[model samples]
Target: MSQSHTAVTPSVNKVVLAYSGGLDTSAIVPWLRETYDCEVIAFVADVGQGDEELEGIEAKALKSGASACYIVDLKDKFVNELIAPAMQAGCIYEEQYLLGTALARPVIAEAQVQVALEVGADAVCHGCTGKGNDQVRFESTFAALAPHLTVIAPWREWDMRSRQDLLNYLAERNIKTTASATKIYSRDANLWHISHEGGELEDPWNAPTDQVWTLSVSPQQAPDTTEVVDLTFDAGILTHVNGSAMTQTEALVALNSLGAAHGVGRIDIVENRLVGMKSRGCYETPGGAIWYQGLRGLEELVHDRPCQRLRHQLGQQLADVLYDGQWFTPVREALLAAVAVLAQKLTGTVRLGLYKGNITVLGRKSPFTLYSEAFATFEEDEVYQQKDAAGFIRLFSLSSRIRALKQGGLQ
Candidate 1:
């Protein structure tokens, strides 16, 4: 294997670790201290995974031999800064994934870097495996933000391979972890969505059982009645849901509750990973689905064909950039710049109906809409000249007509 080389010094006196209070990360603290003879400071980012995942996380990190722990609440930043702009741009990877895991990484890594700088640590660490995209995402952000800081990825360097091995390592050191060999699925969760992999998901032929899902119910189990919610957007920023003003985070939480009851946002896809491998994953983005539909519906009313095409192209490019962990690059900033200009006209309200894993555009209304009732109506309208379409169609098809005539004469 190639060496995990960085330009920093070989001797690291202190390091900051991205801790999840899980089996691998818990073991990593003691391993780092023992191997490097350094003080370990744990950094935890709360991106609204849940109260259960975060409960007593600081104490858990301390128990794992971390000298100190800093748990930063990145929930607001996650929704507002990362998710809101992506939603406005309508970014969905492979036409299905709402980028739940992809969107969370940069913000989390940014916080991790901040903690490292604040404590004057010479190194930063993460527990991501070598096979996953997260390793790229975490390391890329770290490289962009703090190049001088050493990166310690224990999974790439350590001898421990299995969950039982990590558990045994922790046990031997008198460290405790709540993980077991019986754990079925590998999962990542944030405020936007939850992703499931490993377990039965390794094989694309196998379908996910109810146990694979933690956030939403099965489509069959969803309520029979349809539910409608009105979303209001100001300059492409979501401001209210169902007539109540809300922040970006509040709107998503409320929508998730409504959509989960209707089994709205669940997708199973075999996507191409950035590491040049295909992996199967099941993602649940209940609220994201509703927001995506609402934004697109509102876009239709406000954007003309050329403007709409530009927005669609921007979405595709943004998805690729985000999935590849290139968020801090100039390419992403350019895409967002266009999205910002387009969003100035994207002020509207859309009512969406959710039922049995389906989202329907009930209605759309916008002050900036280019759709004029007088021009579109079948009834005679004074504003539009019906005779003008004759000349327009002739000019539109002039090239085709000329080509056909010349070929006919030649034949």
Candidate 2:
């Protein structure tokens, strides 16, 4: 229930900011320094938002009155540690969202906190708006990892109401900004996906136009020919793509290219935000979608019925935990432990056909597969007896039969 105009006492002499060099964060640098009379250090986490966003980011931070700027490359760690675990656990928030932006927040916050400690800062700051989930995500992380460090959320204290307000504020200070009020969308992107919000997206009834998409072509505009890509997994971790061995980052990058060509990962939904509000967004998660299909196919081949059911339960719990910004908690650790055990036998290969937003599983193979052709075959098999099915059926329905008899047949 935090508002954007809350008053707080300023006690910190230095603070590290989770800077994205965006309109909000750029303005935050000068605001924090002026309001608190404290030295501000910008901390940027390069979790593969792309080179264009990162280009000249340090210089921009410096130009915005930050005493120092630290841009840390976290792509490998992000994929291997955050995205991989979420993928293995089947963590899709609300059964449709990939948690792309949600997953990136913790890693970024952790890095920001690290920079704060290293630089001897008394507090950490972020530009997350009070209405959004990122503010909770960032503050919760700061509380968990570095409880003693003061958390400064400028959006919760500043009087700026909109992007235009921020732009005007910067202009008044003679600070140049790339932001324009005419821009229609607010976006967040990383290695896994890109999410589009605001403008047309804020209206649930509005169908996103071609202009809304950046990562993939429209399904209607996709090529007619289907593309088949082979994915290999080792103990639930993706290891290869199309018969070529690749590192974790390399595999994801490759799959992204293939999935994007087919428009395989665009989703538009009205999701429930953690702050008890509904927000509409369009997400492009091409590589993540393909990777999810491959993992699911492999899981189906290896996991038994009970194990599969339990894994599904774990996945739901994990999704909520990750989405709610409880990453550094014991509940998350326990869920991850359960997922890791279930994923031990999830080694396999999956061949999928991607065509115009559709992913079709062509084939699946696993060394630890429990599928038995003899047991499941429709034809005569030596491993089973037809006569035994009668007893199983009777036993399986015994409770129902007893209940019916006790209640005088069909009553």
- Give per-residue lDDT, candidate 2, residue 277: 97
lDDT of each residue in 327-403, candidate 2, tens digit only: 98999999999999999998989999999999999999999999999999999899999899999999999999998
At residue 159, candidate 2 shows an lDDT of: 78
**Candidate no. 1 TM-score:** 0.96
Q: How high is the lDDT of residue 146 in model 2?
A: 96
TM-score, every prediction: 0.96, 0.98
Q: List the global CA lDDT of all models.
A: 0.91, 0.90
- RMSD after CA superposition, every candidate: 2.6, 2.1
**Candidate 1 Cα errors over 4 Å, as ranges:** 1-9, 409-411
* Residue-by-residue lDDT tens digits, candidate 1, 258-303: 8888898999999999998999999999999999999999999999
The TM-score leader among the candidates is 2
